[model samples]
Target: MTGAMDKVGTTGGRKRRAGVVAALLCLVVAVLSSAILVSPGPAAAQQRPRTILDMLFGNGLDRGQPYRISPRYRITDPETPERRPARRTTRKAKPQNPAPKAAATAPDQTAAKPAVAAKKEDAKTILVVGDFLAASLANGLKDAYEDNPMVVVKAAANGSSGLVRQDHYDWSTQLAPLIEANDPAVLVMMIGSNDRQPFYGTDASLAVRSPEWNAEYQRRVDEIADIAAKQKVPLVWVGAPPFKFDRMSEDMVYFNDLYRQAAQRVSGEYVDVWEGFVDENDSFIYSGPSVDGQTVQLRNSDGITMTDAGNDKLAFFARKAIDRYVAADQTSEAPAPGARIDLPPIAGAATAVRSPPVSLDDPSLDGGEALLGGGSRAAGIDFEPSPRDKLVLIGRGTGHVDGRADDFAWNDKSSAVASDDKPVAFRGSIDLQKVRKEQGIKPPQEMPSILDAIMDDWSQDNSQAAGGAAQK
Candidate 1:
């Protein structure tokens, strides 16, 4: 009984201690709750010391300004209200400048407009764009205009570029930024070398040299041309040259046709480079006349790209068009065709005069004929036959007739020895036979034919036959 009483006593003491401890814990919780309720809001809390997490989240952004959505509400100090400049009580006066005389006469001169004055740009920028060919073209153009301060040649070419492959590089998108940045007066372009290949469309690939492909390619070209038009820059589209391969050259020709059509649609200048690099038969040539008309290698060994000479030749076609647009002094009006211009005659020049003709019968034409006792030739009387008869038969009517001895009768003026045929000593005498005998040369005899000899032989044979028969 004593042991049970002691146990009960111990248990009661433990319960009492536990109740005291529980009462203490309740008081502590109540005190903590009251303190939390008395704490400030989030905005106030942000003003307190920050943690490493808060610092990492917005260490750079969270500077002196307080967190605000709108720029007007943003403040350097949370306690201070931002101050703004006071509204003007009176209007401020603008500074006055003297008006230009031109502006007075033409009110539009002072008016605002989008068109840029051409003279503002000291030099015309010739922006050349294309493939590798354009690099050569740019280089040639630079050399061509090296001495001219008014022209500046520049290049923005992309190698292996073309209108057929917009996916590779879209010229329409590229030209906007290009023309904007360059602000060129003239835009020269010579692509299509890399375009003849098959065109890969969205749904399907178009075959090379196909009508559909050509149409799409031309559309791309038109897009590029339109960019220049929008920029108000004159575009000089250069045609592709004839390539080494016959099919490639033919495709280039078609491409040139499309370029020409697109250029015309946009009112752009189309430069024909095909003719300059082709022969009379329109075949591709590796060497041709360059810008200076010197014959040089125009194409590379690959036949696709242009050499230095080739590029110059290609640029030459476009140069004139570019010059026309870029040169402010160039006049579009041509002089009237076939207009006669009278120039002052040369000084001290004599007028042409006609002199009378001196005939062969004239004594003046005969040098010393009177001193030599020679008579002048008769002009009206013609002793010789017609020139036609003399040419037809040489020495005609000179031969003597066989039967008549007097066929060629001589006049009394003809002595035995004619004045022409006489010896020097007997020129006025008539002893010509003695001179002939002294010379010991026989006169010419008649030419004998074999027929006479044959007849004589036949008669002799007939006589011999008759004599033989009589003897028998």
Candidate 2:
């Protein structure tokens, strides 16, 4: 009994030892597998071993840890002190600031600027006069002639002045002095924006647009034009553009007509700027095509004042008249004649056949009173006219051509059939039998039914079998 008990005890000890060995082997295998997965390469393996948790979810260094990059992978940056390369020098380096170095290497500022042309001593002056609108017009004219040294624009405009408020600021009194002082080649006037108010005469105050007020306003406009006329300066009256307000735009229309007559009386050119500020429907627009043909904001937020683009457009219409006057002045002083020299003619120059200049008003330019294709038909050479000639020239319909949808003429024979030598069948809801009969086509014989054909075949086989049995 003692020996058996000792044997069981030894066996139990051997089992425990085997279990411990198996557990150790599994632990070693697990550790080696984890290390293999966590390690990136041989280089990474040489560095400090990372924890399993660290390998799974990145190291705390990425989350603002105070760890500096290793010197092996550190890039040299001047901004970073630790990353900057150390330079070996015999003497101490001087303090460096890039600002002074950049300044020293910079190009000369004066040399980069373009040279501007100087204005001529006898340059033609364009005197612009009127209210606030005229002030805007002056600004536009200045920009227009900014590059032209021979033209100078002078603004003698009173923003609050108009023909109606003569007592406050009379254009009749102010205009003559301005023309005399400037000695302008062209006198441009763009007012009436402030003239919509009531007119005050010597006796009583007249309502705006009234017959008495209109007459008085006309006289005032005439007076201003007379001043420019007496000065021998060419007058250019720029009409008021449409306003944001409908009633104000209507008033401008009436004012423009009066300005037109006044300008006409003095033989001055009247520039109508109404179409520039309005849409196709003649309605006021705050934003529209600019002088460059690009869409841009033209009016101020208040709607009454003009923006830069609006001012430029206003100048555009008035610039034509001013340019004409300036051109005339320039051309008036003709240059001295120079000696003429003729060149030798070429050996083989083709002589151009020059036709006499045709008058635009001449009626015979476009084949005269005769319609197109209606000229006299060629004699003896018989040919049918084209559809266009038939319909247009003769004012007649294109006659029916057989087989076409428009052909309604019914005949025994078809044109298509005659050409192809085959009977053409008509499609649609037409009776096929009638068409076939008209074309003289015989109807096909009726086909036998399936059961009748089977019965006929059976009877022929039975007769052949009976004839063979009788012969046997």
Candidate 3:
């Protein structure tokens, strides 16, 4: 009996070890999947560098600028004559949209306020760089925004590009001039489709410099975002859209998260338009039927690049921000000449609700929104500890309830959860209901707000001491 008992104890210990091992593996996989969701594979420039998949699909942008495209008369350098921006495209008025119904006598109409000149708008221009699909967006902007004199939008797209090893040799240097010359008001960037071609070094740690896939992708986002920051240009990094991705899809996911982190670091913005096209299963099929009584073909015949309709959709959102701004005030400084859009603070913009009961087999929640006050409050992030945990600490989503208008923070990080390695603190709203739901635990209703309870008890104790002292 003693021998049998010893064996049982040993077996139980082994089982516990196995369970922990399994949990750790699951954590790693979950994080890895989430990482790949946004990042793309990499490529170095040498060949034509076009991916049939991307060619048919797209480079992930369906929106664009003030004068999205302006391939007008050839422009010569004002000083050097050799160095010029958009040599082939000078500032020229494009056609008016849905041409305003003419009542004749239109020559006198423009006398109103001396219509603004598109060329002069270049002084406050915004720059956008992306993959080939973004070319249409650039053109669309030129067509739609030629009338807005307050802003000029310039763009350059390289067909198959990576953040680290760009297939198009000229993009980096071509784009650098704008930062050097204009120091733009805003910047819109979206690239990273062909990076999955693999360019890593022998050692994992040396991947980025060595063109290793992972490091290279990070380098791309960081390098781009950092450059924009240095230029004092607000940057908006558009996330890659879903495609009929096989191997590259996973890489795209990883890169997307990196974009978000980079954006937060620089107070930039991340636009995730992946959902506008992808279906419930995350598949990319822009065919089958039509929507809006028109052909439902959202994608080009090639299956990747967007149709004209898709570009309009993407442009609509981007333009709305621009439209909203000018209306706010005449005195408000126009967006920084090269400034990226200034969006609401994203960090600490989370809810207090936690996710409800879920099965052990679920992995979907790992990369999604944290539950907050309006509904479930807590979130169980299956954390996978990294070496960074011992170095710079960080945390995930932080948010609050709706009527919290009076309680917005002095800073965005005020409501953020502390790093997993540290004790969680709170200066902003805390959703107890959300917390309980997330931890799979519940608290009794009689428990007052943690803050209220602590202060009330302390006050009572202090008052009692004062009374006793007086009596003495």
Candidate 4:
């Protein structure tokens, strides 16, 4: 009995020892697995962008292949009054005509209208909206024909902010003050940087290929155009600049095309800056000194923004556009087909001699671009247009070393941090409540001067515009 008991005890002791060994082995295996987990591969998971505005301002957006789509409709959402599902059904199309050859084309689709109805004059002064690109481009504009006195640079309204927020939020409210301070004849919009993603909204989404996003985007374009119409300010649509390393760079291309489409829809002009930045392969490349110098790395250290060479090219295109449009506008008193009646020309130092070869009937321009300016940079600002952190970098700010310039002279307004707010305005600011008091045009609210509300807001403390500042 003693021997059996002793044997049992020995076996139990052995079992206990084995169990301890098994636990230690498990611990060793767990430690090895953890070590492997800690060391990731050199190719880290690319980060997605923060704000829609960040696509331009923030760096390192995911470089996922962008899905291409037609820019005819906007992918942006509306600003205020959350979108109720689209209730209005499409109107039936009257498909009768085969071609207009029989009717002599009915007054030429692109011909200028009578002076009383359509504004054909070249815009002397212009205002811009959305992102630092507009501000930087506006700052860089030069009087191309100095002696002519016909061309001039006037007021500019621009900042960081995105299209999504500008349209959805009350960012458009910021334009009131700009209108009050300086009402330009032409309004240039180079938006789309700030809003392409979710900002100040429930959804944290990337705005590429998302149908839900496109609907909202369209609303924003509509609102912008509506305001321009109300103000009688001929709009010039400036497209977004190109950048490498930005995942949304592909998405930006999609958005840029849409801007062009919106311009046509509203009888405004569209300026495409993308073509200039892209390579022969049509791929985006920030110029570099390496063997792949032409490879599209046109971004700064941060993948989102642009380089100096890029901004200068943009400036040149915009300058040419301003010159082209202004020349046409200043011409005759006659109006265009889809334009409003002309108001008296502002008392400037005599209008410029019109540029010949400029088609009066059809500018033939979807805003033609001249890739002139190059090789200028201001400090952190690049001559190229790329996304900065919370700021889409476009033009070179006022002062920087001479070598940085790529083409045109550029400047930066954001010496400090970029404002989260971009300048935007909806229809008229006049008291609509009071304006509708009487019949046609006889309301107490002093005929809504599209300029009044914008002017008013420009001077007020627009902390609400930046989004973060407003929420706090």
Candidate 4 achieves a global lDDT of: 0.56
Number of the candidate with higher lDDT, 2 or 3: 2
lDDT of each: 0.70, 0.77, 0.58, 0.56
RMSD of each: 25.4, 27.6, 40.2, 40.7
Could you give candidate 4's per-residue lDDT for residues 290-378 as a string of tens digits? 21234434456764565554445556667556655565333444567899775643221223234236544334352334333323344
lDDT score at residue 277, model 1, on the 0-100 scale: 82
Report the poorest 10 consecutive residues by lDDT, candidate 2.
344-353
- Per-residue lDDT, model 4, residue 247, is 62
- Candidate 3 per-residue C-alpha lDDT over 178-288 given as tens digits, one digit per residue, 9 for 90 to 100: 677766667777776655555534553333224455665676667777778777777777777665655566667777888888987998877776776666777776853
- Model 2 agreement with the true structure over 436-462: per-residue lDDT tens digits: 568855447899999999999999999
Error of 1 at 47 (Å): 99
Model 1 ranges with Cα > 4 A deviation: 1-121, 328-472
Error of 4 at 30 (Å): 61
Q: For candidate 1, give the lDDT of residue 54.
A: 38
In each prediction, how many residue pairs overlap at the backbone (N, C-alpha, C within less than 3 A)?
0, 0, 63, 90
- Which has the greatest TM-score? 2
lDDT tens digits, residues 1-472, model 1? 9999999999999999999999988976775565455554556656777656335333223334466446766345555545433454787775698556675566675467544323224677889998877788898888666655567788999987888777788887898898889889889988888887888757999998678876777778788888888898888988877778998777887888888987888788898877788888877888877666688998889888778777667666767677766652322345699988776432211222443354332223324335422355457653344333343444333333322333233434334334435333433464656656687445478766899879988999999999999999
Q: Give the Å shift of residue 296 in candidate 2.
A: 1.5
TM-score of 4: 0.39
